[model samples]
Target chain A: MKANYGYMDGSGEYYITIDTDKCMECSEHFCVKACPAGLFRIIEDDYEDMVAEIIPNKRQAIKYDCAPCKPLEDRPELPCMAACTPQAIEHSW
Target chain B: MVTIGIDVGAKNAKILILKDGEILISKYRESGFDQAGVTTALLDETLAELKLTRDDITSICSTGAGRKAVTFANEVVTEVSATSRATFEMYPEVRTVIDVGAEEGRAIRCGERGKVEDFAINEKCAAGSGAFTEAMARALELTVEELGKISLDSSASVPMNAQCAVFAESEVISLLHANTAKQDIAKAIHDAIASRIVSMTRRVGLNKPIALVGGMARNVGFVHSLNAAIEDEVLIPDSPEMTAAYGAALIAAERAA
Candidate 1:
């Protein structure tokens, strides 16, 4: 299953897309540690497959929660996306 | 047998009672800190008003952000499916559905028979949802209802730059400091929210006629802005907030049958 999290607001569009097929294969759950905001969690999806998803409580504040990692100058690859070896995560800005 | 649908939304909990495929009664209350408790009491209160007993409800399907809390429910459905089912029932011609609740917003594309074709959600931020307008209203020193009413009086369009609700509140104050009209500020608030929703809807393909549901449908100011943003008049079902619950009831009815 492919799940899209985050939202588009007045300022801009911010979305985190996750491909669970790739996520389910990686047990390390590296994204959980990569994000300083603790945005990702390994949850049992509707299909009973354990996959990464944005934490529910964090859904309402994705823009601010993800900002510290994305400075205006010389921003590196997002820590969460950088750590995911399966390449299951993406950000739509 | 009657079937009941409960939607424990982010800000409101709604219950719909259906008998023989028709709505019998529906009610809603604030979700509050105790969603499960509030919903259970709401169901009991609604039943008492109708002089019906719990036994009359043979099945119950729950949906929304707090669906898992409804443990007594016979089944659970996602808000997307529930709203599409209800929208299809109301307007078969509607291929797109937009739902903006307190804390979230989503755009759903419905194919034949309301099966969800594709959908996009503005889930993580409160700015695309009713909660943004609510906070803006507070910042403008007006009630939410008053804010909606005053928005209609505006003749000017002012752009709001803030994406976060907290920052938006600060911006509203700055606009007031600049002596901007209250009505213009209110209109800007609605326009900003509508813009985000329209952008999200476009991603899923804005097939018309669009049906607008959820709590925000009742806000005429938002409705006006949304219609303008979509460039096509949107269809709003009667008592739009209950669409999700009504659809869940329909699902419960099917399961019972």
Candidate 2:
């Protein structure tokens, strides 16, 4: 759970967010690989076709509604930060 | 040559002592909380029970989430490699391996020699992992062990869409309120997870003669759903739970030779 570096938000708080456009463009699903909680998956149709959509499958709707970075303990470790090849994920306050 | 494989899993630690192709001894114990401490204790106790010492083990390997933390291991191997090796050893015809443990689910393709060709793992969310099922079991006031047996008897089937474990629990509650049979609900949970896992397995290309390993592999109901989803008979070893440890042992033996 412990790692180096962090992100900052405009409010002077450190945070990380996923840019959907970058995520869609990225070919490698590194986020899926880096995640410890098994929260992200590439959607597939009934015909068993791998789709390009990437979704965060959280425990509850309310949990998803909360800001992307609620709390370290409340959310799965952000694999997107490590997965982003283009550095599309920004950890800022 | 004597070899040993230790699987320091999140919930349990297991040791397998082997000589050539024969299993000398195997032991599994609940890993209360500490990974390193519990693994050390388990290894010590198991070695003592077998009247063997650390030096008696020519090579040592570790597998599972806490593999890296096992200081006793000479080499740390990925679960994908270990699972495929173990599955291939158990069923030489097995070309695919599906592992569902407490925290992750993985599907691996093996080469003719049992080397990992390609693999996919679900380590990000609980929806497709055993933790989701455990959570659902807790909410239903049933032990996780009861779910598989109970689910096997259900005639009716329900559909659950929530891919998130927490959301899935809520869905199960709603279904229970509607007088849904527990078996039906359990079956739905297995089905939902199977669909997700099958999708990943298909992504990696599911060949025939698949082997299911890991703790969740013990769930007969889930195995049925997995088989049905993939449209193939999922091969499960008699000691499905020990596959990972066995795989580690296999690796240790090879290293020693």
Candidate 3:
């Protein structure tokens, strides 16, 4: 299951996509520590699968929160994605 | 030349026609699923009343949530910039701005030219926005307007523990069953929203001469709650809901110039 967390408004679209299927196979929750803002958390989804999800309060402000690691001027692979060896993470902006 | 701003908000689509900073026509309608269709209809109605055509307008800027749906827009501005422009045009002294709309709440630190230096928004949570008030009003069997007015009658502070709007509705029902005063409950609802908004606003640093805009600005109860939370009365511009659209029109005019 691909879970996209974020929102779209007049400003722009900001979302963090996580593939729970790939996440389920992983024992190392590196994405949790990889996020500088501490936005990712381990949670049990409705289907009882333990998955990494964006924290409730921080989900709305990911654009600003993720800016440090994902600067537009000289962009590199996102910390969260680079930490996720399963290649389960992506960003929509 | 006439410039136009169209705001396709979550709850309403509003259009403003401006010429030399003077508003010629302003109109709004309850926004449904078809954002662009609804806005075009609203624009047509306003133009019909003003005896103007799209060609007569020098430029058009679309803003708010559904701004992209307005394909005819010459430009699209974000809500933060739109709010900043409108605030500068209306209250240049304002150094901070808090806008609470139906779906979102934002706190902006404004610069001398009404530029947004920084902003924090409550986007994913209904508890931090006007939708929470609407849910509470429905649970209390009162109109949204009536709930705001009725809350003003209560002096007692009732605490709302639920941070989610759906759970808050259950909390309201429980309070009602326990024979709690409706006005007190209303006040609690507004207070809860205010606390959430204030916390978010604090992130951007709430400066003096703060201005409040958006549809929620019209709620007197919310305003009073916000004042008590911040220990200051925020400035409310005329037609607070229209401020974003007006700001967009101003941006359109500047871009055209």
- Winner by DockQ: 3
Docking class of 1: incorrect
Q: Tens digits of per-residue lDDT for model 3 on B100-143?
A: 99999998888887788888777866777899899999999999
State the lDDT of candidate 1 residue by residue for B71-137, as single tens digits: 7898999999999999988999889999999888988989998898888777766777889999998
Give candidate 2 misplaced runs (Cα > 4 Å).
A1-93
Shift of residue B254 alpha carbon in model 2, Å = 1.0
* Superposition error at A20 for model 2 (Å): 15
Return the number of clashes found in candidate 1: 2
Tell me how many clashing residue pairs each candidate has.
2, 17, 0
Ranking by DockQ: 3, 1, 2
* lDDT tens digits, residue span A34-65, model 2: 64444456554344544223343342221222
- The alpha-carbon lDDT assigned to residue B208 of candidate 1 equals 85
Candidate scoring better on TM-score of 2 and 3: 3
Tens digits of lDDT, candidate 3, A3-56: 999876444687999999999788799999998889999999899888899998
In model 2, state the lDDT of residue B54. Answer: 88
Each model's DockQ score:
0.04, 0.04, 0.05
